[model samples]
Target: MTETVAVVGGTGTLGAPVVRHLLDRGASVFVLSRNATNVPAGAEHRRVDLASGEGLGAALAGATVVVDTANSNKGAEDVLVAGTRRLLEAGAAAGVGHHLAISIIGIDQVPMKYYRAKLAQEAAIESGPIPFSILRASQFHQLLDMALSAAARFGVRPTGAAKVQPIDPDVVAARLADAALAGPAGRLSEIAGPKVQTLSELSRTWAAARGKRRLPLPVPSWGKMGKAVAAGALCNPAATTAGKDFEEWLRHE
Candidate 1:
């Protein structure tokens, strides 16, 4: 039997690749989002709003699995935690067998507000009605690049002393696709980059790869969040590691 998968936020960075992988795996794919303009070519686009819970039940109908990659930095509480609860409610009503979500590693250890929201989102999924799988991954190489690029515009790259193990989102997306196919297994093994490096080192490598000479300013992390980052709370050495590191990913970008 053919499996039907619904990918929420399917046009975003990690979500886009997940749609491609699910398509590659021959699953019937639906990209559920508020705006369908950028939805991938092969998958069907369904207009749905996670925040409002509009169109969710209809959009998720007939789906065997739902992969929630939806995220909102500005509205983390409304869109991530509450939206996840809304998604789970709709998924349950639709008789969706598996609810799969992508989360960050060490959300529990990190005291950041966004991580707290994500942790709440995970809690929602765990306590929800449907069987679920959650894949906790490290920071994405793209996220680090975005941070470095933003600081580069100011003439210097400011980096914290925090250590990060950034993984390629494409690799993370593939793992998500596999999990969507593998059924609900609860929390899966975490995923991270092959090597763990400090933010300053990642900045230096990023600058070198782009052939730009920029001064890397060292910034100290303070408070609980900073201490957690410095303690490598974002990295998982025992987790599965795959794909390009920061330098290799920069080469392609």
Candidate 2:
């Protein structure tokens, strides 16, 4: 019998691909999300909310690994931290072996509210008794696109108070799946794109893609600690980071 993998937050962007990759690798997958109806055809879906501690224990049963991609904008504590606690506790009771979490780079230095939440989430997964790997990633190209799209609507494509090393989500999913197959490496290596570009350049890229020229205002306090790319908060693009660049991702998409 093949191993079974559970993808927490499987409904999210990255989580969906992780599920598909696991299935392609001959592993049976359980997709845990609030909406069970939309889970892919081959996978079994369960309705569970990690925030309320609802149905988590039952959903986690009989799994070999749990790939956690769950997050909420509310804060790190309420969703990432608390949901992880519920899942880890349940995974332990259910005899789950490995735990994998998707995280972000520059979480420590940026002091961004969301990144702080990410850091806290990482800490929770690490301190849990389960063997785990926290894969920290750069801003995904899709994330960049969304950010740019939101900015373009306002006709203000702001230039850099910060930089982003954007990676494709396909590469991110593949790396996460590979780690799952290898079991736990405690805390594994971080993931980043090949190039480093500022958000201004990102806006230009998006604007050009749309057949228009645009510029964004450099807004302060875009997010917590968002003003300090000189601090290299999002500038570390180690070759070991893993993943393709935004241009490449756009080509493939």
Candidate 3:
């Protein structure tokens, strides 16, 4: 039997690759977003906003599995937590069998507000009636690059001495697509990069790649969030590693 998979936030960085993977796996793929104009041509595009719940049910109707890679950095509460609640309700109503949500690694351990929102998002998924699987991954290489570039504007890069195990989006997307196909396994194993590199090292490498020179500044994090990140709580040392390291990714990408 053919599987119909609905991918929320399918046009975003992480979500786009998952959509591609699902399509490559021969599943009938639907990309759900408020504006799906940029969604790839191979999959069906459904314009639906999770926050408002408009067209959500119709978009998710008859889906065998739903992969939620949706996220909002500025509106984490509205999009991550509350929007997930809305998705869960709609999925349950649509008789969706498996719900696969991609989350960040160490969200429960981190003290940041965004991490807290992710925790709430997880709670909503866990308590919902639908059978669900949640996969947590470390920071993405793109995100790390963005961070380095943003900090480089000041002529110095400050990383707060946080250690990151950054993974490729395509690798993370493939794993999530596989989990969606395999059905709900509850919380699956976390995925991470091959090496645990400090933010300073990543920033320096990124700067060098850009043909720019900047001093690596190790800024101390004072609060609990700082402590957790500094302690490497965001990294899953035991998780399976995938894709190229930062240097290799930079060269190819």
Question: In order, what lDDT does every prediction score?
Answer: 0.91, 0.80, 0.88
The regions of model 1 sitting more than 4 angstroms off are none
lDDT per residue as tens, model 2, 128-226: 979998888877788887877777777777676467788877788988988888889977778788778766676677777666556558755444475
Which scores higher on TM-score, 1 or 2? 1
Look at candidate 1 and give me any clashing residue pairs.
Answer: none
Clashes of each: 0, 3, 0
Query: How many pairs of residues collide in model 2?
Result: 3
lDDT of 1: 0.91
Q: Write the per-residue lDDT of candidate 3 for residues 151-230, one digit (tens) a residue.
A: 78888877557889988899999999889999889999999988898877887778778887887677886688888888
Report the Cα lDDT for candidate 2: 0.80
Error of 3 at 171 (Å): 0.4
* Best-first order by TM-score: 1, 3, 2
Q: Weakest 10 consecutive residues, lDDT, candidate 3?
A: 151-160
